[model samples]
Target: MRILITAGGTSEKIDDVRAITNHSSGKLGKAIAEAFSAEGATIDYITTKQALHPDNDEATIHLIESTADLAAKLNELMTAHRYTAVIHSMAVSDFTPESSVTIEDLQDTIAAKPDDLALALKEKVRERTEKKISSDTDHLVIVLKKNPKVIQQIKQLQPETILVGFKLLVDVPMIQLLDVAKASMEKNDADFILANDLAEISGEKHHGYLINRHHKVKEAQTKSEIAQLIKQEVLKLEEAK
Candidate 1:
């Protein structure tokens, strides 16, 4: 079976040098990839540049930096190749910078001299429309906007492909976590959803659940166990198909 797995945290650029990203080590995803590869499955592992990836000859690795990059690659790969399943374990950012203003623009707009400040501000606005803003200034403002739900597009892109998604909650009750996980599965049209809580993950024991349309099928107390369970679930999906 051919499988496409995405792991890691996607970043959103705030400026040339600054970005917003989440805390994902890509360990679980990597473990899943390795497990599948060991079973003689072809694995296409797409991950962020910051993620910790595995060194396996059986798996092909593709590195991406931002949510846009991930979306484009997924579109391209889904179109170019036919996969049996796709596991989206990446932590995609919900919001991205709507508009990024350079420090130069802010500096020109709020120049110390009052008379020149107005003229400079007007000129800066006009220049902003004409050219890319420079980032050499001291301060900048980055406006954030909601990003498209990338996972929701998976079923639309490849109707036959088995889709697995992930839901992460920080310090939430078990009931609430399961509720959100179920909602995510329904909304994304996923074959399965892995729900994890940050509070539990931070502890010595990492806990997670694998939920399907019927109910929660498996629970894992460690990262390794989560990876094994994911592999088992994928096998079950293939067998059912």
Candidate 2:
């Protein structure tokens, strides 16, 4: 079977030198790719510049930095190739910088128009985005806008592909984690989702629960095991077909 896998954290640029990103190592994604490769499945890996990747010579790789770049690349690839499955493991940012302004300027606007709070910023505040923000300002306020859910776009592009999503929550209880994962899976129309706890992940100690549309769940304790379980599930599905 042919498969597409995305790994690592996408970086949103704040300036030429700064960015908004996460701590995802992309180890699990690499492991998953290797697992599928060993089974003789074709792999297309989309990832970032710094994340870990599989050394397999046969797997094709695509690089992306920002969320927008990922969307564009996915559009191009998904349209060009017919993938049998897709595993989205990338840690995408939820918000992106809309604008940035000095705290002093914001305060000045509030002071000038004390009566109407919303009108003050709407009329006086001038948003700016320099190639490199000046360090002269003692403080700055950055307005962020919510990003579109990239995972939801996968099934829309390829409805028949076995879409597998990953949900990572930090310090949440098991019940809450699964519930959130289920909701996200249903919303994205994913065939399977792997719910994992950030607090529970540490080297080989990583724990994950893979749940399907029928609510059938399988447990795995490490990145390797997770890859194996996913491969097994996908093979079963391919065989059943």
Candidate 3:
């Protein structure tokens, strides 16, 4: 089957040299892509420059930066090709830097004790003009804005593609994590949602639950195991279609 996969984390620019990003290593995504490669499936891997990637020469690579960049790239590719499946494994940033300013620059507003700190900062923070923020200030304020849900747009753009969404929680209980995953799956129209907790993932002991459209769940421990489980499920997924 032909597939599309996204890995790593998006970096939101604070300045030309400074950014806000996550610690996603993209190891699991690489493992998943490699597993599909072993089955001789045509694949395209979209990832950040810092993330891990497949060694296969057959897989096409698309490097991306911010969440908006990722969304734009996905839109272009999905519109151009009829992919059989889409594995959205990237840890996209939820917020992006809207403005940055120093406390001294907003001294008048701060002294007024505005109740809404973010709103006050947004109204007063100067738009970034320099490549790098000035280091002269002892304190700095950065205002961030929420980003669009890129995964939610995938199935909307290509409804027939088997969409596999991933949900990562810090230390929530399995029940809560699965509940959130199920809700996201429904909202995003994803065929499968891979739910995992950070506390449960360590080295080769990564654990996840693949929750299907029918609410049926499959447990897979380790990245390789998860990839195998997804591979097995993909066959059943196509058969159902």
lDDT of 2 by residue, 1-241 (tens): 7899999999888767888896789999999999999989899999998999887585788999988888888899999988889999999988886655678867787667578654455344345434566779989876667888888889899988899999999999999999999998889999899999999999867899999988999999999999999989977876776
- Number of clashes recorded per candidate: 0, 0, 0
Candidate 2, residue 59: lDDT = 77
The 0-to-1 C-alpha lDDT of every candidate, in the order given, reads 0.83, 0.86, 0.89
Collision pairs in model 2: none
**lDDT of model 2, residue 111:** 68
Q: Evaluated with TM-score, which candidate comes out highest?
A: 3
Which 10-residue window in model 1 sums to the lowest lDDT?
A: 116-125
**Candidate 2 TM-score versus the reference:** 0.91
Model 1 agreement with the true structure over 1-241: per-residue lDDT tens digits: 8899999999998656678997798888888888888888888889977898878586888999888888899998889888888999999999986555666655546666657543455455555653455657677665577888989778889999989899999999999999999999999999999999998885336799999889856899988888888888889878998
Candidate 3 overall lDDT versus native: 0.89
On a 0 to 100 scale, what is the lDDT of residue 79 in model 1? 90
- Among residues 3 or more apart in sequence or in different chains, the pairs in candidate 3 whose N, CA or C atoms overlap within 3 Å are none
Residue range 181-215, candidate 3, lDDT tens digits: 99999899999999999999998889999999999
Better of 1 and 2 by lDDT: 2
Model 3: worst 10 consecutive residues (lDDT sum): 122-131
lDDT-best of 2 and 3 = 3
